[model samples]
Target: MTQHSDVVVIGGGQSGLAAGYHLRRLGIEHVILDAQAAPGGAWQHTWDSLQLFSPAAYSSLPGRFMPAQEGEVYPDAAHVVSYLADYEKRYELPVQRGAWVSAVHRDGPYLRVETSSGDWRARAVVSATGTWTRPFLPAVPGRRDFTGRQLHTVQYRSPAEFTGQRVIVVGGGNSGAQIAADLTGTAELTWVTQRLPRYLADDIDGRALFDAATARRRALDVGRTDTGGVASLGDIVAVPPVRAARDAGLLCAKPMFTRLTATGVEWADGARAEADVVIWCTGFRPALAPFAALRLRGARGHIATDGTRAVDEPRLHLLGYGDWTGPASATLIGIGRPARDAARQIRDLLG
Candidate 1:
């Protein structure tokens, strides 16, 4: 027998939890389903030492504030997971953990979510799976033949694991840079990326980024008729990890690899660099394959939602999508409005 709900939220991360909380506040009956056995989603799987670039004040969910000191750099992965668990319990959000959603289809008027455990039907669906579902590891030729161990940054937990190993950290993103810096003291480290990464200043924290993006979005909202997508202004030229690496004389900006060999990685310029380990911090793809019929607009498999609301399917909403304007869109702080808006929209539809 298929269980039923007025609305079913897929993915029990910050977005899903916020959605459930708002729905409950509006007297809507809903259930949140998450594939993970616990609540924090990808955060739980993050490296143990990982910390948010933003501060704790900007990391709170809708109802509850993050239990941390003001102006403190955001908590690590473990603290984030603990906070999510606390949020779930405090709000009494109806979350079914370890329920991996296999597929989502529109069955007549309701949305059918088929999971490993069972199936559920709902009047509406919110895809809060976030953008980091699948790690993107480039398949360079001879990668399989690499003599040293190769791992994606997703599986990487600490530099201690790669101690005394000559490690090549690919991709110049924040994660890659940080991992390289962390390994510098313990191992021989080299940083690589296709383009010189444009680093945003440390002052460009999550709140500031959200605020600037929000103002630009509101201008467009008022019929200003700006050409092209909202251009990200402000100083995004100082990647923290890159700056740290430069300060430590450990930064190396280079083009991506042409192939991987048993001995080492070969650059597109036909130069070969040897290493005992390769850490690919390429990036992540969205978890939208299950909802393939939605026809999203973003490159790299991200669902292109319009300011918290999904574009193609207005009834189907997405929260916590990366790169949204406002202090509350991508961060835990920004998720509240989107979740509340989605809840209101669902309540109206159900009524």
Candidate 2:
């Protein structure tokens, strides 16, 4: 049987939960569908030692603030998972877990959401299925020919398996820095980047990043000078472990290698390092496969949107992808604004 809802949120992560919270507040009936068997969304898949740049109090959804973890300043992945599960229960958000969304297509006046559990026809659909599932490994030359083990950031858990091995981590972002740091004293670690890694000031954390992003957005909105939000600051934040690693000179990064040999990688200047493992801390693209039937994405490989609402298809909204959707829509703290706007737009459209 085909079910119905006022809105169908196609993810139950921070963005989806935020949408549900706002919709409930506005008395709008909606349902959140999640592919994951439980809550936490992509956070559940993060490495074991990963910690947020911000404290628990600063990382929260719309209605409720995340409580401080008992002994930690920055909460770990498990703490975040527990918080999300509790939030879902506390708000009584209608979330159907393990309901993997296959596709969403236009159905006359409504949108038909095809999922493994069932089909739902909704007045509006919010596609918040974030970027974790689509881990991006760049097309480095000889990447396929390399005989050593290779893995992306999503597959990494801890450094226990990498002991006594020569490992090279690629990417200048926080993930690479953190993972490199995690391997300290364990693996013969080598960090590589396209350019020299830039670190934000020790005082700068996610709170500062959020504020800067908000300021930059507001400035751009009024046609003022573009204040480079987080971009101007640096690429990586010095979270505790990362900071310690950098201070100890363990985060020194080498220029990106030109190609991979059977056993290792060779740099541009003919310096080669033998490696047993290579970890690509690259990144992810949005999981927009469910929206493929709509043919909404542009040449940049993302859907054009005006404040979370799809420009061409007004009934669809893309949330939590990144700044393209909203200023800081991908972060737990930044998602509320966009999610609220999406809910409001849906209410207005359905009314």
Clashing pairs in 2: none
For residues 16-72, could you state the per-residue lDDT of candidate 2 as single tens digits?
Answer: 999999999999999999999888889998999999989998999988899999889
Model 1, TM vs. native? 0.87
Global CA lDDT computed for model 2? 0.92
lDDT of each: 0.76, 0.92
| Model 2 misplaced regions, further than 4 Å | none
